[model samples]
Target: MKIHFSARTIAFALTSCLFIGACSDVLNSSKSEQLMTNPTEVNITSIDDLNALFDKYQYNDASWDKGNREVPRITFAGVDERWAEGSKSLPVEIKKMIFFRLMTPLALVSNENILREREIVKNSPLDAEKLKKIALKYDILENKTGNLDESMRTALLDRVDILPPSLALAQAAEESGWATSRFAQEGNAFFGQWDFSGNGMKPLNQREELGDYRVARFDSPLASVEAYMLNINSNSSYLKLRVLRSKLRAKDKAVTGIKLAGTLDNYSERGQDYIDGLRAMIRYNKLEQMDQAYLSDNKLIHLTTEK
Candidate 1:
């Protein structure tokens, strides 16, 4: 999965159509106007500092609505360096906070793309050029017939589906044990994603019946988050979740994580119990409030460093 181009180049290509300026202007304006503050960098030197930061950004104010204000983002540098030495609580809290901050931006980006595509589908005729663009963007077959059928519509919707922050947080917590699991600590595999290519960390107790699958390794936690979102958006297993999200969007309703949890029975071996646990985690921790969270105008980048 080596990307040939730099991140800046990819980002510029993605935004050039939406912005009204040269590449440098687009880059500078995004940083200066959209970003209200410098990126907050958190070096996890001690548990006390981490806890204090979480308390500072706690979303407990009843007046705060998902539609009203932007959610702030925080970055953690050298996140994997000190996790093994700390108490379980320290790593768990750190992982939870990281998940909260990371998923907000990803969801916001996905929702924005979904809205743009919906408008395109609603307003424009499905010309050859438009269909080709859609196919290229979503990895669909461009050689197909030009008709915009239900299958094409469903494909577009599924690719643009957004994952709920609460659902993502709960799964991360359950799969990685608050980022203390061996895969997460060693390979940045926050979701326990499996790679059958033998390029990841092997589970010590993987049963023989499960086939030869290793926990996917990532260069950083942010990479893991991106992969997780892509999995939900594009994988066939999560089509039910995408369908549920589409219905909610059609009704102009919010996509709550709890409602979407029922569709994720395929995500794990626990079946109904997994969904119940996710909903329970959401309710017990009041994670529903984060469903409406949006990234602040300020940008935050999570960076990883070598030990």
Candidate 2:
């Protein structure tokens, strides 16, 4: 079954809009709040039903239709638990296709939110108050000053930019095992983020030295993607990656996934070996082409499961 609701009919004002299925609640900006006021909802009971919906929307899972890279605005609030078991019956190629297609919209939408925030950061000089809020939001610990100086602006810009979709997709695939891992299936944790707050899922083989840290959990897949991007942008360990991206921007070069993937040596314990795996995934899947992809300017499509 399917349902559609115009923004006007939703009983809430535009000021409170959240773009729920695509935009992350934790990462919402003014521009992000303005999108997808109207949404279409589809209910599915299995992977086949989900694929049928994709077909109906003309969402091609095959290489973005040979480089025509406009992705349909099909977002899933969360994955149906059935997919994990049902997908095992499918071939590897088909499984990869389904996972990529399911995840691409979340990555694209998260990037869109960051780009909007980046625009605000770019014009930070005009509003010191807004600049301070942004700096705090992105965890700029160096800037304790009330003033929004050029240096602060530069730092915020370095940390507020969009991540390449290829890198995000590759990491999600590797970390969550294509959303079949216990963390992803139970908690929507795609990137294996650790939380020391004692409100997360504990791993079966957690090291005692790491304390009581557990993998961070999220309400939705989009939220997981949002948190992952925020971690990459603001975490101290990924500073080198941010610096490399800024250097690429300074040269007016494309900040590609392959280029930034080189600096992710600190992201995993395997260091260079983990970096090699991510690079291989990006190249093998031709995910670099996804960097140019954007969401179609159509009504948002939310995929849910039948009750």
The 10-residue segment of model 2 with minimum total lDDT is 10-19
lDDT (Cα atoms) of all candidates against the true structure: 0.59, 0.75
Residue 105, model 2: Cα distance from true site in angstroms: 0.7
Candidate 2 ranges beyond 4 A from true positions: 1-34, 45-52, 55-58, 61-63, 80-82, 141-145
Q: What tens-digit string does per-residue lDDT give for candidate 2 at 1-307? A: 1222332322121111112244335335644444565567766544455556666656664444656688776666554455566556555665677678778888998888888778778875645666677788788744656566677688788999899999999999999887778888778899999999999999999999979999999988888998999999999999999999999999999988999999999889999999999999999988998899888766677654434
Among residues 3 or more apart in sequence or in different chains, the pairs in candidate 2 whose N, CA or C atoms overlap within 3 Å are none
Candidate 1 residues lying further than 4 Å off, grouped into runs, are 1-69, 89-139, 142-154, 301-307
True lDDT of residue 106, candidate 1: 45
